[model samples]
Target: MRGSVVCKKIAPVGEVLVKVFPTEIIDSVGEEDAHFFGAIDTATRALRGGGVFSVSDEIEGAALLHYINVAESYRNEGVGSKLLDYSLKSMKSAGTKYVLYRETADNPINLIISYNFATDNGFIPIVENEKILSYKMETILGGKFAMKMMGKKDSLNNIIGIDDPKDNRIIKFNEDNSDVFYKLEKGNYDPCYSGFYVKDDKIVGALRGVLRDKTVILGDVYLETGYESDDIYTSLLEYVLILLTQDVRVENIVIQVTGEKRRSIINSLLGEPDAERNAIELVRYL
Candidate 1:
């Protein structure tokens, strides 16, 4: 599949995108972001293979590498590597840079991309030059969900009484249950301030959090969809808030979630929309 692999630029539109990109990511892009993304010429590599990048006047000689995905069948076929090489060559010449903000996901979907992207955890290097560097960027949410800045009473008031979960025990991930943990959330599995909703020794829902200094950064929640998913999610999230507050080290919390409905739910708890802070940013100087 080496010589067979061909990287071609495709128009960034819903019709062409549906064939190459995930619907969740496609639908998640708001109108403003959609326009920003489509402003450039990208490509449709394979069935589930492609990448999205954007360059702007807002940042000089820098670009955003939105994402690069490949189908399972295309794995190890150099499809991903070719796509990256081609995409970069297609970019704004030497000295230009590219960065990406992807949650270090360990799930199956992300694992495949990681392999294609050559990511150790969530980042990979395109070259061995000094310009190549990848590090974890602590994404901070600024708006209604900034628990650290919010008063203790204010934060607690919003989380309480979300939904009554029958029996939820905070789970610390370990060697045995690490596999289950990945299924629940999309990011890397960390034991600190994270847990799952266990029923009969099986994980039904889960939430992941990282305690960084005085601020606790939250990750995505993974729950098997069923009856009252919203209720269960609310309950799990609310319960975690209670547990974190007990730790004297926790003075603030940074939560990252997707979907407008979920955002609205968090906004309801935190008050009104404020502003979103820096989340994931990657830098690569060419």
Candidate 2:
């Protein structure tokens, strides 16, 4: 039974997956959660001995390990390890730089097991609570940072670096920005919440944000391919930080970045990772 187990990606169908998957995920798959399993890059699968796993596509530059379940009978037989190994390999091949996993922390025993499992597989618990546990894959960073923000008050003009009073105008994202947005998107930027960086009446950069469950998730701090520079990055993130500081109800901030360039920028702005109360998120880096 041990050596015979094989792991592979499978459609989110069949008795094996349905039997082992969590009830909520089973329902979402039934409803066709494209966000969860729609992309060609996403993997949803079942393994030998009634085990199942799923990895979301690289959304906002990171893939999420959204689901994994091994039947009780298969728990001690290495099924989880086999499924995780396959999923990580596939995700890395798909150009995923970061991966994340989340587990409920309501049960102390389960939380401990989950934490141990994550660390064993190169993950670190960033957010630990009785309600939720967040784990991110561990990596050797140069060091940590202490967060800082500019003291001056920020507005659209200041954020866009518009010094000329004659050319100054603030463009908050709305229906009017849609035209310029689609042109810049070029099939890359799809934002649920965002701010645009305009300079001299032209859009030079964009800040994308998505709010989910009281957490504001940042997507892209994008300037055109060759047009990127350090200041542009700072202005964009500073705007988001200012906005978040103004909101009293926002519980957390998540930035999803693809390569070292953006990751470095995020690290600089955030100045080190801090866990939110009772919150859980999963993260991995390639």
Q: Which candidate gets the maximum TM-score versus the true structure?
A: 2
lDDT of 1 by residue, 1-286 (tens): 2225566666556676876666766565532453221112234323446776655433445555666766666677666767776766677453455543343442446434444454532344422211111112222233333464454443233232212123232333232344322432223434556656665655556676766568676766666546236756665666676566566667666677655666665656554423353233234445
Tell me the tens digit of each residue's lDDT in model 2 across 1-286. 1335566655555454545556666665352531222111123233433222344433334565656656565577666776677777776786666676765544467656766776777765544332311112121022231125545445435354332223323233323344332233222332434556766666567776656567776654667555588777777777766666556556666665444565566666554555322334445566
lDDT of 1: 0.50
Ten contiguous residues with the weakest lDDT in model 1: 128-137
Clashes of 1: 6
In order of listing, the candidates' clash counts read 6, 8
lDDT of 2: 0.51
Error of 1 at 93 (Å): 25
- lDDT score of residue 88 within candidate 1: 68
With a 3 Å backbone cut-off (N, CA, C), the pairs that clash in candidate 1 are 10-42, 10-43, 99-282, 139-279, 148-252, 184-222
